[model samples]
Target: MGESEQKVAKEPTEETAEVTGATVATEVSALPAEAPAVLPKTPPKGSKSYELIFLVDAALPKEELDALIAKVQGIIEQREGIVENVRVSDVRRLAYEIKKRTHGVYVVVNFFLLPSQIAELERLLRLDERVLRHMVICTRSS
Candidate 1:
């Protein structure tokens, strides 16, 4: 082919550029540059304090209850959480029956754990048959 014909063949036309997305790229490049987005700082992992309260069968012997509490503490420590305090209250009557039990022992634990690990901890608690009911709350604001 002649030099002019070769040039015409090699140069991309508007339809070819549009079909190949080259026109979109060029249009994007022609726009003004934008400043980088500023994201808010997040609290450090494992810095938040949380409170875990769980109820167990009131009929359980003291030794078994103690062991159960220790097991829960172990679960928290396994996830790199620090257990600050553990309070086991005397048997209390439940407002409503849970698992056909009207009485339960309430155990409260204060600990520091990563927010991401909270869901896993809850799942573990829910799966424990010994635990009649459980709830975790953030003890301190992030």
Candidate 2:
């Protein structure tokens, strides 16, 4: 091998057991390609308020949609937001199909978030492909 051509080595750790920051490759030649893992999350803890409504794939079961709703609710709670209510309005035909589906499930999540925390919540939603449509509007005092 030329002086310019050299092999590089990497150190391993318990998390992924690989080089750089990537998980080490486990030999399973027969297995199909692995799906990407979701990134680590840091949640907030405390009191806050906001309202978020989103549309999910109606084809999914009540449990499945509920599971995802729970996940989002957890994130909100972690970030100091309090979950007030979660309403799941299952599969309704859209005036027209969205993302090629003629129907979708609706979810309304009422919560309280710190004024500064809205951006974080929005970012999480943007990253999740499950949401077909979403809106977060600040509430006025009653």
Candidate 3:
């Protein structure tokens, strides 16, 4: 093709660059200034809140049941963790049998502990035969 017929590529002009920069600046400035109001409160440093739910065999006697619960709380406290709350619900029929048991006791414990110690806590809970099933969930935003 001849030089005059060939298409030429043009670089962005000074005005084009200025307009792009101004558009970005305006978009950033449009964000809310009070962002903290919409954000969740951060927990204390080096610790996070977690909720532990476990199902225990309902056939256990009252004394043993109480002891097991206390033992779990003790484990958390022994590791320098704080127990916020413990809710023990009466034995209820399970949606499906767990370890051949139709009814089970539900225990919910909320506490704060270091993230690194979660594996150890879960290991200890798994060793107890009375606890049929258990789950740990983080309740606070990282």
Candidate 4:
């Protein structure tokens, strides 16, 4: 391009001006040197309520399913978790196939557990062949 075209291209437009203004404001209003750094707030040190939902292979026998549920309960209890409820739904057809299976047995577990132990529990579930899919969500009011 010519020198004039290059100069025009380099000129700051309204968008660039606004961006520069914001950047300047952000830099100037940053925390003062003497101010303490901010930290994230954490919940009190106690068990947190959570609901765990998982899908198991539908083809498993009733005895096998019971054993799987017992194994899950054991994991939670081993991690200082308290199981409040354990519900199992009948084997039903799935919307889409998983692991070449057309149906799954749905199980929902409500419990109080430490947040730190959730990862380990999920890891165990993931490694179990009986489990097809699983989800864990907080049930705390806050």
Candidate 5:
């Protein structure tokens, strides 16, 4: 040991992890770098959330129902959202007679939709007088 001897030590203040891209710094006894944080969990587009169910009038003929369903499917597709499932319950009976027909067709569809697009769908259904009654229900969230 003499005047020519020298020692080097790391000062521990705060060091950030470059890999994580975060402003927060971490303390370590050695290199003292924070561990890279993993990406926040995000629900996939096909998540079971955003469950939506809409009931269409059964008064319209089978062809009309098919057409409307196709159009609606297109709209939903354009939104880039996945359709989990669709159920159509066209019960051949109505609370009252419709168009002098004692039996009315009932249709039920379940699909996901954006909040903004809901208004547009409602408008479309309203334009069609053939629908006796319609109901829209959201079952889940994403």
Candidate 6:
């Protein structure tokens, strides 16, 4: 063949197998044309239960604290979530001072919301100055 002319070989089918000095032929079909379907890794898009715990500056007055909690609740409500229960603890000393304060108010909240809305809720909490720390946990059904 010329330098510009290249040889192209076709793929071997299952019917043929090459031996050291002979050729053998059999009959079988090629590999499957498509892969099997796979299910989604997460549950379907819908309301899932969650728990939220947050710490706020202890020195703030009750009115300020209420407003702060309301802001969080509003975020959840805006995303079509229901705030089931809220528990606020009296000011207590922290293991270490935060934002130059020795005490903080601990708040626990249980709610139901779509999984897609959790990130936005966290972003709002992270941006609030009064909120010192926060954690969100998905609660599995019993």
Q: Write the per-residue lDDT of candidate 3 for residues 52-129, one digit (tens) a residue.
A: 999999898767877887898899888878887787777799999889999998888898888888899999999999
Candidate 1 lDDT score at position 96: 96
Q: TM-score of model 5 relative to the true fold?
A: 0.51
Q: Per-residue lDDT tens digits of candidate 5, residues 1-142?
A: 6775443345556664332223455544342245475674443454333443444455466667667666766766676555555546545665676556676545555566666666676777667666555666666766
Which runs of model 6 end up more than 4 angstroms from their true locations? 1-45
Give the per-residue lDDT digits (tens) of candidate 1, residues 23-136.
332222222245376674444564698999999998987778777878888998888888877877767999999999999888889888888889999999999899998999
> How many clashes (backbone atoms < 3 Å, residues ≥3 apart in a chain or on different chains) does model 2 have?
10
TM-score of each: 0.66, 0.62, 0.67, 0.67, 0.51, 0.66
Clash totals in order: 0, 10, 0, 0, 2, 0
How does candidate 4 fare on TM-score?
0.67
- Which of 3 and 5 is the better model by lDDT? 3
Lowest summed lDDT over 10 consecutive residues: which window, candidate 1?
Answer: 18-27
- Global lDDT of model 6: 0.78
How would the candidate models be sorted by lDDT, starting from the highest? Answer: 3, 6, 4, 1, 2, 5
Candidate number of the best TM-score: 3
What local distance difference test score does each model get? 0.77, 0.69, 0.78, 0.78, 0.56, 0.78
Model 3 misplacement above 4 A? 1-44
- Runs in model 5 deviating more than 4 A are 1-60, 98-101
Q: What's the CA RMSD for each of the models?
A: 22.2, 13.4, 21.8, 19.3, 20.0, 23.9
Q: Candidate 4 residues 1-142, lDDT tens each?
A: 6764322213323332221112221222434456698874443467798999999888898778878888988998888778877888877999999999999889999888888899999999999989999999999922
**Range of the 10 consecutive residues with the lowest summed lDDT in candidate 5:** 16-25
